[model samples]
Target: MKLGELLAIIRRDELDDESQPYLWSNAALIEYAEDAENEACRRASLLRDATTPAICRITLVAGTSEYDLDPRVIRLRRVRLTGNSTPLVPVTTAQLDEEHPGWEDETGEPSCYLTDWETGEIRVVPTPTAVGTLELQVVRLPLVALNDMEDTPEIHARFHRDLRHWIVKRAFSVLDSERQDKDRAKDAESRFALAFGDPLSARTEEWNARNLPSTHRDGSE
Candidate 1:
């Protein structure tokens, strides 16, 4: 649905504030709509892009082991070099520290990478000596905001309408006297959660993102 249509629905049917001098302004509701859309993406893992240049492809710099990932990336799915066939392994930084001390000082084909959520960077093990590319499959949040009437949500249509529940919750939770409705806000929040369960944690998201099996016994063929 168009942002304009969703806004109209919220104002007319949901908020019942279609009268002049709307209880909630378009700007505030638009922000809430964005929040809802982001929440939907995170909670439902709705968008997985391996083709989007900004979201999926990472250019490599020779001798550089660590690089910043796009901020929208929520979970790293699979990462591989442009010249390689098998995807690189994902590992924890602590594991590298303990098992392969001075790993960052070495230079070779990086078989593993670790994501630093705090730094928003991924570090390749054993550093790279040659220029290359890291192709990534990732689960990401929406890159665009619903600030304009013409903007359409990137999530599936089935979940688009459900976003209204979150917008409604935010609308009622507004601090203004005319708009505040704590009881209704909580109810809407509950309904929204029921409709879209809680978002995945970092660990859970990582686990869900992985698809390749570790051995032939796992039936890769």
Candidate 2:
């Protein structure tokens, strides 16, 4: 939904109008909405793995082991040698250095990759002699700014409901604290926890249910 539409929803839900003693202006709500959107985007990316963009492929340059990654990459999921379908073994810089002391000097098809998330760079071991393709799959960074009221969020539409509740939670939190309405603040918190928190729990629970049986479940019975 558009930012304007979301603001209207928040106003109606909170019974916030000029007639009310607590004047929640559009500007204030918009600010809260932006904050909520940013928070929601972060949490969804971390908890839900929300980014599912197409895999990116870069041609390997002979004698080059380091490559600049896209700024929009939030998390690098996997690196593979394109057309081979086999994923590169991810290793730390220390591990790579220990395993292949002359990795920089070596020139062949890269069999491993090291992702430097902090630096936004990827390093390949053994470099490349012949032209080849390196494929990277990553969780994309979210677009946070909503300058135009008509501009919609970059967050997936499926999670918009949770995003809306989070916005309400933040707005009510500020409004309630300002008005000294503790009850209203608690209500907003409760609503947000129920809508957003439960789903997060469900994701964990579903993962455990699917994987725990084979890995961690007691089989003594």
Candidate 3:
């Protein structure tokens, strides 16, 4: 659904009189809509992109093992040297330490990759001796704010309806004299979780623990 259509429903459901003054202004609602899309991307992995060069391609610097991922990237899925058929395997610092011992000081083509989500960096094993490009697949948050004027969300068409649940959740719980409705707000949040899946913060904690290279010492799997 487009932003305009979504806004219309939110207005009607919330008794937001567009003809009259509204507690939930268009600007605020747009922000809420943006929040919902971002949350969906974070928890549900809605946007899986492989071809966006700005986010999916990295230039490897000779002797540089580590590189920053795009800020919007929520998860890194794969990495491959531009012309190589073999994909770099995921590895952990602890695992590397156990096997290679001072692997960080070595130099060669990267055979494995390690990610630290907390720092938004990926380290390629055996810093490259020749500069080249790495192709990537990633899950990322939306690149821009919702263009309430005419643009629709980057979220897929099927998931667009579910996005409204998030907007309603935020809109109703707004701490305003006329707008605050805790019961409805709570209900909306519950429905959104049902539609999108997971309480994101709790899910994030589990995800971080599972993905932390230190925790996954046995990389043989």
- Which 10 consecutive positions of candidate 3 have the poorest summed lDDT? 212-221
TM-score for candidate 3, residues paired by index: 0.90
Per-residue CA lDDT of candidate 1, range 1-221, in tens?
Answer: 99888989888878998887877888888899999998888777788788999888878788898899898987776778887777777776677889889887989988888777767888887788888889987789987778887888988887878888899999999888988999999888888887788756877755554332121222132
User: Highest TM-score: which candidate?
Assistant: 3
- Superposed by TM-score, candidate 1 places the C-alpha of residue 96 at a distance from the truth, in angstroms, of 1.6
Candidate 2 regions exceeding 4 Å error are: 15-35, 46-55, 143-145, 169-221
TM-score of each model, paired residue for residue: 0.89, 0.65, 0.90
TM-score computed on alpha carbons, candidate 1:
0.89
Deviation in Å, model 2, residue 122 alpha carbon: 1.4
Compared with the true structure, what per-residue lDDT tens digits does model 3 show for residues 7-28?
8877886545567577678888
Q: Cα lDDT of all candidates, in order?
A: 0.80, 0.61, 0.80
lDDT accuracy of residue 146 in candidate 2: 67
